[model samples]
Target: MRIDLTSVFVDDQAKALDFYTDVLGFEKKNDVPVGDARWLTVVSPEAPEGPELLLEPSGHPAVGPYKEALVADGIPAAAFSVDDVHAEYERLRAHGVRFTQPPIDAGSVTTAVLDDTCGNLIQIMRVA
Candidate 1:
């Protein structure tokens, strides 16, 4: 068994694309129109054929409250692996991205949390 795709609910697909691609460094994979929302997805530039991250719309009834609760509790909706958490965090902060939590060492791993601007908190991490 293997994972092919996963999703993060987003309030705005356009903004999500910009952040995920321009800021977070993911590459756009697929973008097909599906009614009011497009079937948007992104893949890591290092792994173009790997699992895709779907930017799903938050139009569903339960999505808003679920996202709100997650944010209220300071939880990240998704996590991306980086070679250096501190470097990535600094680079992102230089780009005007807002981080909810600064990079902190956690045993063999280090992580930082940032607001995705599309109504979700995302974590960037690295492992030692």
Candidate 2:
């Protein structure tokens, strides 16, 4: 068995696209309209054919509370692997991204958490 796709609930698809692509460096893979929302997904540039991250609409009632609770508890909505967690964190900070947690060495890995601005916290990590 293999993973094909996963999703992160987003308040706005357009803003999510910009942040995921322009800021986080993911590439848009698919964008098909579906009713009031679109089937928007992105893939890492390094792995165009790999698993896709779906930017799902957060119109559902449960989403708001779920996201709020996660943020309140400092939980990341998604985690992305990077070659260098510190470098990625610095680059993101320069772009005005607000981080909830700075890069910290955590035994086998290093990680930092940043707010996605569209109502989610995302983690960038590197395995040692």
- Give the Å shift of residue 18 in candidate 1: 0.7
TM-score, candidate 2, is 0.98
- lDDT of prediction 1: 0.97
* TM of each candidate vs. truth: 0.98, 0.98
Residues 1-128, model 1: lDDT tens digits: 99999999999999999999999989999999999899999999999999999999999999999999999999999999999999998999999999999999989999999999999999999988
> Where is the poorest 10-residue window by lDDT in model 2?
84-93
What's the residue-level lDDT of 124 in candidate 1? Answer: 91
List per-prediction Cα lDDT, in the order shown: 0.97, 0.96
- Alpha-carbon RMSD, each predicted model: 0.5, 0.6
lDDT of 1 at 62: 100
